[model samples]
Target: MTMVSNEYGKIITIEQAVEMIDDGCSLMVGGFGGIGSPPSLLQAIIDKGVQQITLICNDTAFPHIGVGPLVAQGRIKKAVVSHIGSNPIAGQLLHEGKMEVEFSPQGILIERIRAGGAGLGGILVDIGVGHEWLAKGKPTVDIDGNRYLLERPLTADISLVYAKKADPFGNLIYDKSARNTNPLVAMAGRITIAEVEEIVPLGELDPEEIVTPGIFVTYIVQSNGVDWKWIWE
Candidate 1:
């Protein structure tokens, strides 16, 4: 079989994209309650059964959607995320000592990812300065008597994102609230794979509308399969 040599210019299959990942990888998944999650790519990853993956996402979503299946499948060894309220599977796994979960404030979490993309060491925020349990030995600095905790950058081996539209060069546009967290996740990965609903010609995407430039995207996959509906949806 002839492989597509230029990942940015052409669309790759879900299998091709999934095969790029390895076991024990740190991954950033873009979504908020399954809105911008990459279902086909995730299903591919689930099929691959890559174990010990550490996922960073806004939420775990439902047990059958987004990163929840990975948790239910016992593939995720650790997760660094903002909330697990939507998915009881994550909380159950954590309680069972089957998985480890790291909590983060939404703003602080995104800033850490942004810092990594910008090549910054970290950012200072007072979000958790007073909570000694949350500080966990992080050094604090006083800015003229006010104190703040230093939150370090977050980078990942792989990033999975979903887009409403993408050009052949991988420039992306997202649909409404679905755009949440995807742009940042795109930049924080060493290898970013985008799952897009539509792939158009290289010059078709409007410059201003493209939230994520193709420069940050390493590969592209056309969206496939039926949409996974949440239990509440």
Candidate 2:
């Protein structure tokens, strides 16, 4: 069994943060690909060798980017994602029957995650009503003669996020495009950990600039910044 620190403060080491994730746990990762992904945290989890992760993310990214290494190493047992086109490994795993992938329309996927965080049972959408795969196994209802599929909420056992800056209390502000899906992902996890490039003192961050309030963050880890070369290759 892994020994996790019992310290009460939200600031923790990357190693300590990854310990909270066990094998077979559901993980929500915030990123469009490699851009906003928490690289150091993800690498730490890979080093720990926790397997059978259920990953929820926007995409699988490239083989060397974002959550791609996890998929390449067969760490992921299932994925709930918008697409896997960017990551050939993920597509291969799906085609070879080694992994299960649940495809959701991009907009609806994020909405489901938001609904999860907001404590809603689910949201109704008409986007996939006639589609064979998207409509499968989902219940539907008609309101005012318009039919909609019930897209259930999505929540994870743990969530990993990246931020541009963070305070001791865990208030976060993200970099431009890197902010994608992170705010919503932060709210939907039972335990949300943020990997930040810089940690500032409390009140140093302008309130107007804070995108994710400290209330949603459970832990903060200092980032060992990503290698852009690997992501660009």
Candidate 3:
């Protein structure tokens, strides 16, 4: 088991955060592309040689960014995400039958994760009903004379998230557009590790400004402060 402190949201090194995970673990990673990815923690996983992971994220990101490196490094065996257009490596693996990829609608994907955190059985939606390819073998629910697909909740052994700032207690505030899917990702993991640019004192974060509550976070790692220039810029 990983170390747990009563001190509440203790800040640890990326190496220590890596110790909490093992090979073949299920992970939910928070990011749209690589914008809000946890670089230090992701690097730690690469360094530790963890492999055969099942990843849940919005996308695989570009080949050089975010969890894309993990894919490039062959650490992921299966990925549940919206698309792999950004990462040619992921697409290569998918087509080669080297990786198992599950495609889910973006809205349904996040909602399923949120449902997992909320302890729900699953959710019902009609996004893929008519498309037999999308519907596949999933069970259908008829509610109020309408049919919908039963989307199962997705929970993970651990979740990795990036935040702009965090209090010692683990309350987080993301930077601008980097906030995507992080709050939901923070909630869906059995244990969540946050990598943040700054870790302030416990009271530094205002309650109203806090996006993800400390209760959802198990550990925190300060960011490496490397500037990630946006491709658009």
lDDT values for all models: 0.87, 0.92, 0.90
Query: Per-residue alpha-carbon lDDT of model 2 for 1-233, expressed as tens digits?
Result: 32323244999888888889999999999999778999999999899999999999999988887899999999999999999999998999999999999999899899999999899999999988988887999999999999999999999999999999998888899999999999999999999999999887776899999999999999999899877875444
lDDT of 3 by residue, 132-156 (tens): 9999989999999999999999999
How far out, in Å, is residue 5 in model 2?
18
Task: Look at candidate 1 and give me any clashing residue pairs.
Answer: none
Hey, what RMSD does candidate 1 come out at? 3.0
Q: List the residue pairs that clash in candidate 2.
A: none
CA error at residue 181 for candidate 1, angstroms: 0.6
Candidate 1 vs 3: which has more lDDT = 3
lDDT of 1 at 157: 95
lDDT of 1 by residue, 98-191 (tens): 9999988888889989898878999998887888799987889899999999888999999999999988788899999989999999999999
| Model 3, residue 53: C-alpha shift (Å) | 0.6
Instruction: Pick the winner on lDDT between candidates 2 and 3.
Output: 2
Instruction: Highest lDDT: give the candidate number.
Output: 2
Q: Rank the candidates by lDDT, best first.
A: 2, 3, 1
